[model samples]
Target: MLAALALGVKDLVGSTGFSGEMLLGLIAAGYAGTDFIEGFMEKVPLPGAGAGAVAGPGSTGSGVAVLPDQSGNGAAAKVAAQMEANLASQLNAQTSQLQADIASLKSTAAAGSPETSWALLTGPSAASLTPDLVARLFVPATPRANIRTHLPNVLAGLRSCDLIDRDMLLMALATIRAETEGFVPIDEFVSPYNTDQVAFDKYEPGTSTAVKLGNIEPGDGARFKGRGFIQLTGRDNYTRIGSQIGVDLVGNPTLANDSILAGRILAQFLANNEDPIRIALADGNLKVARRLVNGGSHGFDRFKDAYDKGLRLIPEGVEI
Candidate 1:
C-alpha cells in the first residue's frame, strides 16, 4: 500500500510537475477523495441541510434529502435519537480529551515542577479522586503572582489528587522555573535537533508497507517518527514502552496527544528505570533533556544535565 502510494506520488510528481493552481486543486481533490473513501462521508449531510423531505431549491439554499423514518418498520426515531446521543457522547469525550490535554499543558507550564505539579494537577481532575478535606481547603483566591494563567485549575487538580503539600508545591514551582526558564516549550530554548535520534513526541510511522521500493528515504519513509510531551523516540524505545504500558505506542502514535496518558507513560519509564537515570547522569550533566527525551543514555553519555535539573526542580527538603 505504501509502495503504491509512493509510486503513485512519484509518478504524479514526475508526470506533471504541475505548478501553482493546478497542483493545489489536485491536492484538494485528492484529500476530498480520501475523505469520501473513509467513513467521513457517511456522517456528513449535503450542504443546506434541514430535518425532513427535500424542498425545492431556493435562493436561501438547498434543503437536505431526508429518507423516510424507518421507525414504522421497527427502527424507531428513538433509535436515531439514541445514535445522535451516542455521537454526542463520543464528541464530548473527544472534547474532554482535548481540554484535558490543553489544561495539562497549561498547568504544567504554570505549576513549574514537571513531576510533582503534573502529578498533583492531574490526580484531582476527576470528581471521584477529590477528597472532602482537600476540597474544603482549596481556596477560591485569584492565582498568585508567580503562577501563570491556569494556576487555579492546576492547584485544583493537585488538591483533587492530594498529591503534594503546599510547601512542596512551592518548591516544585521554583524548581521548574530554574530548569525551564519558567515552563516554556522546549523548542524556544533548544535548537532543532541535529542528530537523527529516535522520533519522540509526534513520531508517525508509515502505514503502507511498500514505501521502501522506490526513491524512498528511510527517515522520510514514515517509520517511528517521534512525538509527544517527553518525545519518546526510536523504534526500540517505542516497542519497549508500548509493551510496558500495554499500549501500541508505535502502532497508534496519536496516543501522545493524550496528555495524562503520555505523562503516565513517562512516569513509568523515568521513575521506574535506572538506565534512564544513568544516561541522564553522564556527559558531565551537559545534555539533560535530550538524553531523557531521546534515550541518549542508552548508548551515549548525553543526559547528566537532565537528571540534575530534574532533581533541582524538586522543592527544598523533598527527597526524590
Candidate 2:
C-alpha cells in the first residue's frame, strides 16, 4: 500500500512537470506511512471549494460529504483547513521555481546560438505559418477573406525567395499592407502624392526621375508605374526583376498584378535589399526599413502598424 501511494504521488508530480527535489520529497513523505499520506490528502481542498472551506458530513461545500474524524471531533475541520493552506503555499513556490528554471534554460540555449536568439526575438519559421496566425497579424479593418485568399500565394512568394525566417516574413507582409491594404496588386494612383502631374509627365523622357527610372519614351511613367504587392515601379525595376523571375515584365508590365507573379516579385524585391532592411530593423528604425523599399516614407504609418502588430501577435519561437 505504501509503495502504491508513493508511485501515485510520483505520477501526479511528474504530470505537472515538477521534478527533482520536490518529487523526491513527496515520495519520501509517502514512504513514511499511510497515515501521513491520508492526513495530507485530507487537507487538499476539493476543486472549486473555498480555501477556508472544510469537507465534513452534510456539508455541500464541494458537492460531496466528507465524514468528520472519529477523534479530534470539531477540531478536525480547523486543522484540515490550516494544513491545506500550508500545502497551497508550498505548491505555489514549487510552481514559481519550475517556471524560472524553464526560462533560464531558454535563455542559456539562446545565448549558445545566435540563430536561436534571433528566432526568439522575431518569431518562428515561415513554413509553420497558418491562415489563422496570419489573420492575427492584421488589424480588424483589413478583411479576413482577403487574407485567407492571398495567404497561399504569400507563402509561395516567401518560399520562392527562401525567406523562411519569421522576421523576414513579417517584413514582407508589412510591406504588402503598406503598399496595398486591399491585399491585391494595383496600379499606382495618379495623384500629387504619387506623381507630380496627373498625366505622369514628371517621368517623361529627359526628366531626372524619368532618367533614374529608365523611362526613355513617352507614357513610360504610367506604363511602368508601381504595381504588384511591393509596387514594382519604374522601367528599370520591371526589367531587372522580370529578368530574374523569367518574365517579360518590360513588355507586359501589368503582369506584375497577377497574384502569383506579384507575390514572387514582392519577395524578390525584398531579397534584393535584404541587407539594408535588416540593418535598419536591428536598430529599431522602421523609417529606414520602409525607405529601403519605398524610397521614402510613403506608407510609413501602415507599414509600422502591420509590423508592430506582427511583433505582438506572433509568439516568439513558437511554431503555429
Candidate 3:
C-alpha cells in the first residue's frame, strides 16, 4: 500500500504544478513535527539543496559546455541554463516522490505512529554528570550542595524512561535545573504569593490552571503546589505522575522533592505520552519544549541557557 501510494503521489506530482520552491519549504517544515519522514526525505533534495546542477551528455559538473565557445558565442551560458533546468527537474521529481512516500508512511502508521519518535539511546554515565558541573549549570546554594547525590537517581530514571538520548537528557537537565532554581528539589516558596507559606500559593482552587489540574480541596493549593525538579504541580498532576513513577506524590506531596525521586519524576514527565518534550528535543526546538513543560515561556531563557551548558558537559556516546 505504501509503495502504491508513493507511485500514485508521484503521478499526481508530475501532472500537478508543485514547483521545486514549494518542495523545499515543505520538506523543511515537515522536519519540525514528523518522524520516520526525515530518513527518507534525506534522499530527496531541492534544486539548490542538492549539489550543483550537472549538465547532460558532454557537459562537466560545472555544467560547462564540452564544446567551448571558441567564437565567444554565449553557447556556454545557454548550456548552463539547460543543465540547471535539467537538475531542477530531476530534483523536483525525486523530492515529490519522496514526499509522497513519506505521506503514505505516515498514513499507514497513523494508528500507532507516535507524535514524534525520539531516538532511544543510552547517555553518559551517572558519574559523568558531576556535582561541580551541576553547580555551574545549576550550582545550588551553600546549604543545597548534595544535588549531585541524586546522580544515581537521574541515571536510573533515564533508564526507566528510556530517555538516554544526549539531546533529550540535556533538554531535561536544563529544564530541571531551571524549574528547581539550580536543583533545589523542593517545593516552591514565596511568602508574597500567599499570606501563609511557600510557593504556588497564588494558585487557589478555582483558579483556572489549578482547577484544570484538579486541585479542588480547600488546601489543595499548598498541598499540591509545584514540587520535584520539574516542579510537578496541582493535585491532578501529583496523582497522575505518582501512579506512573510508583510513588505516593498525592499522599506524601513532600516526596516529590526527594532528591532521588525528583530526578526520576523529571525524566518521567519528559518521556510521558506523545513525549512532547522528547519530540521537541529531537527537533532541537527548545522553545517548544519549554512551552510544553511550563504551559508558557516562563523562565524559558534561563532553561535554554542551562540546557546549552549541560550540552557542553555531556559529550556524545558516553554510555552507562
For residue 49, model 2's alpha carbon misses the true position, in angstroms, by 18
For model 1, how does the per-residue alpha-carbon lDDT over 247-290 read when each residue is reduced to its tens digit? 88667755743544454444444444434434533433434533
Q: TM per model?
A: 0.30, 0.62, 0.54
Model 1 worst lDDT window (10 residues): 182-191
Clashing pairs in 2: none
Once fitted onto the true fold, the runs of candidate 1 whose alpha carbons sit more than 4 angstroms away are 1-223, 275-320
lDDT of 2 by residue, 1-320 (tens): 33334235444344447533234434433444444445445656567664235455546554434445557566657656666678788666655554444454345333543223333433455325666556545554777787778878877887888876767888988998889887777888787744664567777777888887899888898899889899887899999999999999999999999999998999899899999989998899999999999989988898997887677555555331
Candidate 2 C-alpha error for residue 317, in Å = 5.2
Candidate order, lDDT descending: 2, 3, 1
Q: After superposition, how far is residue 225 of candidate 1 from its true place, in Å?
A: 1.5
lDDT of 3 by residue, 104-222 (tens): 44443332311111110112343265565455566325234555566667767777887786776676667766676655577676656333443565577756766677888777887
Residue 238 in candidate 2, Cα distance off native in Å: 0.3
Which structure among the candidates has the greatest lDDT? 2
Candidate 2 Cα outliers beyond 4 Å, as residue runs: 1-128, 195-197, 316-320
Most accurate candidate by TM-score:
2
